[model samples]
Target: MSAENEIVPPPGAAHRFAVVGMGATGVGVFVALVRSLVAGGRAAGAEVHIFETKERLGAGVAYSTPHDCHLLNMRASTMSVHPDDPDHFVRWLSAHPGAGPAVESEYVPRRLFAEYLQEFFEEALVEARQCGIKVRTHKSVVSDCREDARGVHLIAGLDHFVFGRVFLCLGDLPSTAYLEFTKLPTYVHSMWQGAGLETIAPDATVGILGTSLTAVDALLQLRGAGHRGAITCFSRRRALPKVQGPSVRYTLRHVTEENLGRLTDGFTRQLEFAEVAELFRRELEDGLGLAIDWKRVLARPAETFTHTLARDVERAERGQTLWYSILDATSEIVPLVWRTMSAGARASFMTEHLSIWSMFRHCMPLDNARRLLGMATDGAFTVASELSAVSYDEEDAVFQVSAGGTTHRVRWLVNATGTGFALDCSDSSLIQNMLMRGDITPHPLGGIDVDFDSLRVLRRDGSHSARAHYIGPLTRGVHFYTNSFETNLANAHSAVAAALN
Candidate 1:
């Protein structure tokens, strides 16, 4: 075996595992590990340690929001915590009618999802206990982690613990953009932070950065709170996310494992960008039974933002968005395709196609889109492209935002640009400390480096830590679709299997 893949004996108990950060990813890893231990006949006297600082164990930042307007992007049918069982979450929601309506194909409020995760986690804990497994929870942030000859050492504030294996599921990081105005009360660096949009006056003009889903959330929250001020979304492209349509299941033909195997000659070669694009083209064309206008699809629409949104809504209502269904069907194989691509191809996609790709892939719910359309029709919201500069005037207590060759002044500027992937700019001291100690290395494209198969974190010297595994959105560099719950859950299972093996 390669030196990096070598496994060492546990210093103490063999079944002791530690999961740092009890978000969705961390919860997945913990549950998978518990089930694996029980299935492998190792549950007797087995112990699992969970470390998190959040008030809610499994909610994390993504679903912790109490706003009903902040809806999940994906449908409930696909948001199962169990990768193998797609109906797990839906079943849970059915059992608890007070949580929210259980529409399997509909997008529910994120807070409802949070309740689902917490309840699922509670059930897992009960099952673990019944199986003679000891589950422990720590309400402290993990400040640092280091592996030595003994075991994996985790320092959480004043306390310290050791475990046979450690899974890092730190979730998404806050955006590091617009740091210069962080001290300004009017400039909100993160929309998820404490009392985010509530501080903005009802009549305050707002300028939100980026036209991603996060920006959509900000706008919806503002509207939900009865904000009557005009809001302008600023971004380089200013293209809003596509609206999700009816859930249609599609079987892939071109972007399948068999086709990929044939193209790579049994996994001997890296795939070129053009080759992958052609496969996608074939898949979309086959699904639609018509030729796709690549230029028209990729290019920014000439119509106004409201018109485009209305048209997308109409198309979605008519179920004419078969292409989106086709794209969604390829989610399972996306990581495999990404891993097989040459580095140049991956970098090229990140540089040129990531924005547009995200705009389509991470879409808003039809409900939210319709509400945004209403706001647009009321002349309270607009999107501007070609965003250049933004500066704050202390005397005037307003922000000057330059975009589309016009400068607009707003009372508040929000950095709704979404998650930041740069580790150097991470807000977590644990990640910062790990980087300083060479416990982890950053990926060239983004996030930290990890073994694509085992999810073991690779160190500065290119050696994989035997006891440390990272599975979260920050692993996007290794798995392109890590943002999705399904991908993260699958990764959690893989990491547990590797750790137990």
Candidate 2:
């Protein structure tokens, strides 16, 4: 471990690239790198490295979690590493003789997807090494990052990994942000806390603060664990994810490879919903000339950003006058609507547009949510809104909440308010460290303030990170549709292009 070989600052640091958080975004970037360098014949000459805190590379928090029963909102066929290779995943599934026949396109187990990604990266890494690309896997978290003329230097496990360019593939924060109910000990904080449902004793009354997919997962876990307790879920407006069912049109498979190259540009530039539907109808009839399943189209809006925006605009336009009512009534479509709003727009909309959301946004599932209602009607689980905690008497295991100024007392409360964001997070070592070192800055609650076009990191001081770029939720403010495979793939395509240049 001499000074020279002790992994000191290497030469040509500016030409190197270090990526943090090896989730889907990381996988996307890894594939993007191979595509770029291999295409340029510099694959072996390029230095690309990733620092991942997750137990394995390419399976950050999202996929790293060991929840198999929890199905992906998406089907396996759609989650491909290469945007151009539309059937990459489907083909992979088929090629894996052990995986069995082409069964129904149901939500695949999250673990299977994780393993698929793991295998994909391992193979890609081998290919990368064959081309002379240097791929380093550090099992540590990046506590901080600094930039100098040499480029971006990241502190991972006391070593400085310098890179000419950096891409952050970090996903959402740990669910513990909702520990507000636990400000007193009577509540359990961080639903991901060890089979979250197990915390509540059988027959004990507990409250959940969120109404999204996470909450549903927790509910399912609780029921599986045989907890006959009174469970209460609190959300300003809670919505259940739409179920998988029949569709009117097929999935939008372009936005990539062909870029619908076979189609016309007048085809998909919709900033609104009707325009999108019309484009799809026309494209299928005039170009591909077939009916696209409406169900599939709605379910897989993953690609069609223009269509998504148009849909949200349409949703908003219809409910403008009935704001709160619309949000309350259409509660089932939050995920879709949420996807459509830009990060900046989301922040602004979430704040001032509470009325719209309250009326239309949060929805309980008509069928699946019946499980929740059963719990409620049976007097075991109660769902409430506008809950406020009065105080906690930790010793006595009593927590109080006030809604509409009326305080309700409970033996315990669970803070399930949902994920913490940049604005709300101050103690995360990764984020705090990044902020302190001026390596990255949190954008206004809307997102990470990424240059929508370049995907470069916009510093807290209002400047782009000389070498760093952020992907995933960090870019939510700018891209709005980050964290999805489609968005990640798009980001990889765009940012890697910049890196190569």
Candidate 3:
């Protein structure tokens, strides 16, 4: 190894730590690791290496958007980096008045959250330095990682560095589902990649794939830019996300650890899908004080998209959606529920209820919902379900999208289908290389397999790595609730604790 790559510890330091990726997840790991080390009197002369190619460290892809139109789905009260302190983000917002308005119950722009994260990270760096911890940042992508006797090795470009422990906090991976159209000038595969939406002509028709939150973001951006084109959001189920209502504090009774433990016989038995469904049913009915009309909630409504949007907005405005509050309360125990489930149960949920579940669970803020309703009423765009197929016309330079038994031609096609979880199909060389070397294995449901409690990566041979821990959205299959910042932060603390132990 070269002199720079040598694992020589500083004069008083005995261990070196490396965090791959400087997104929100990475920032969480770094902060948690620093705090843990300082508390344990191990921070003196310790080295922390952060690897990322992005100009901004903590913004990541989700919060990196500069547009004010893209708002956070969660309210400000719950968007804190410290899991124990629910008001941490709100306090930060209070201190930084120039960032944006601070309303604990309101959904703020994502850029503001990005600023909070960057500031939080900077503060952590200051603390780390004061405690005699050496911080190093490598502005390069980690292409591969391998763990052996010496330590965990991270290969970034032509350079290699080994650390006593490595935390892989790489954020969401872009969807490769529509890679065929990637080369086409009219098709934008990843919406977050710079200035893709700005290239669209003001009057040209646009077709957006997937009606998830990302699709909502694209539509809002197009509208904010004063695009006069008719935009159509295409999806297989044709269902838009539910709108957020007034925040309500709910204490979980059904989906608690005690209940789960009893159901799983102290977690020795795997839970069936039906068992988990019953728990949710009971919880929802208990919260609403009435039996739920499951058929109505699950079935595709006969009402048009505009009608559904309006009704949901009205319900949200009235704060009559107690089910949402109840569901939100269950976020803490979702991963435990997922872990107790049998493999067959997990597979069944993924194939059967994933779409509808996502629509209800991952909701949009009321502000965006009202904006979408107005746009729909004004005939700016329409959401179409039953997306059958799509084809590109080379000579015409337009996309032909077939949905709901009608073919619509659009000059621009945007894929807002959200992040891809398939490891083998990932665009990241680091993930692909790790998979190839048997350092990690794909979870059957989604993401990479990991030890649930420790957050350590599980290899193809069914052994957990001692020095490597994986966190972020890629742990979705294992955690089932890894998308939220709070969950990722908690997981980071868990991973760092395990690493230190």
Candidate 4:
């Protein structure tokens, strides 16, 4: 490409900024961009473009549910978009009566959180307008992105545009691919897509893939819709997420940054996996005021998975799991710990500990756990561990799932396995194009590789791309906590600061 063609700026445009995928992550980036542009006195007639194919911009797939049965996994108190205010969303909820009660400790519906995000986005836009920034929304898919000396060029449909910088705040990747079940009428690739769980027959024997939060959402939706068929959830570990408990405040001890420094010998070298694990063990013990029974938790020879879940829920009900706050507090320094870990240690964490970490960290609400236990006790739901050899019979139009020497057939299959992060395995055209052109490289753990702090997309040649910045779950391999709104918002702030600098 010629320098003239690539280096040219948009006509009459000063400081053009583009944010792709206007989901929760994108909205957070938008807030950071507006604030940075306005604070830097660059918002006068600055052009800001947001691209999304969804009807709504800020809600994203996670929060776009209209069902009242779906609830936010976290409490209302901790979901603020702005870190400085800390209670902005909670305060907004207090002011708006239509959003149900504004109790900070309550687990509000995801739709209510969506409303809060939309309102927050609009308020930010209004502030942008006050500073003479033009905010434009493009309801279309971004096909390709290529960078040059001048800026980044984004292709949306037949239209092409260049921006000073682009924030690829792309939300969760597409659902996991099921090549064997492709073209089968009974197989649903994604439960979050069009028609959702409603497409399943009311009396059909339904098989749900994975026992994560997504599976729980599907289960609740099906129950709410009056589905009475047998529902079996497949899990490799047969472990359901623990229940969310009442708000607990605790002091940090062994997980402190100072302790991390001491462990690393004043940050002279990379951290080992064992050292980090030991620190966490101490943290839990100190925070809980009781030593955790590692042997019982790991072995669990006598208790069922559902029984373990019930025990945790019971602890939550009795306000005894104050140790949960330790994990909550770890959020502040997770990036530091994640980045300093050796590559091999990081990979070990991904392979051996990630699932258990998720089981504890991404727990469901207590009410949801109760409902799940109730359904399990009623014999309407069954969870199987180590499900292997999932095959579909085209003639019978049934999916045969095998686990632990038992085979079960279901007429309907739902791939609620949640989003996959492997960039090479991604079916998205834009991501594939970027990888093909070396605009981004795949991380060893998962997702696209990027810089440790700023999140600038790193090319195959080990150079960072000035044109593109990624701030999403894809960065989890390096950042370790990109799944939360708090982490994404923090990432956006850092990216914007780096870009401005």
Per-residue lDDT for 277-360 in model 4, tens only? 988998888776788899876552367766776788798898765756678778878888987789989999888888788887
Superposed Cα RMSD, model 2: 9.5
Task: State model 4's lDDT.
Answer: 0.83
Q: Candidate 1 lDDT (Cα, whole model)?
A: 0.89
Q: Name model 3 segments beyond 4 Å from true.
A: 1-14, 100-105
Tens-digit lDDT string for candidate 2 (1-501): 566555444676755777787887788787787768899876656777878866777766567556544556555655777666867777777777545643244455566677788898888888888878888778887877777755677788778667788887776665445445544445566655444546577777666666566666677667767887667666554333323322122333322224332333433331233332343345344434455465653342353323332344444334322322322222222233343434454656557544333323232222334444455445655545555555666666676666535656667566555445544354467677766766566666544667766688777678886567777766755664454567667777788888778
TM-score of 2: 0.73
Q: Give TM-scores for every candidate, taking all chains together and pairing residue i with residue i.
A: 0.96, 0.73, 0.96, 0.96
Cα lDDT for residue 474, candidate 3: 87
User: Could you tell me how far off, in angstroms, the CA of residue 72 lies in candidate 2 after the best superposition?
Assistant: 0.9
lDDT, model 4, position 167: 91
Worst 10 residues of 1 by lDDT: 97-106
- Report the poorest 10 consecutive residues by lDDT, candidate 4: 5-14
Superposed Cα deviation of residue 35, candidate 3 (Å): 0.6
Q: How accurate is candidate 2 locally (lDDT)?
A: 0.59
RMSD of each predicted structure: 3.1, 9.5, 2.9, 2.0
Count of backbone clashes, every candidate in sequence: 0, 41, 0, 0
- Cα-based lDDT for every prediction: 0.89, 0.59, 0.90, 0.83
Cand. 4 TM to true fold: 0.96
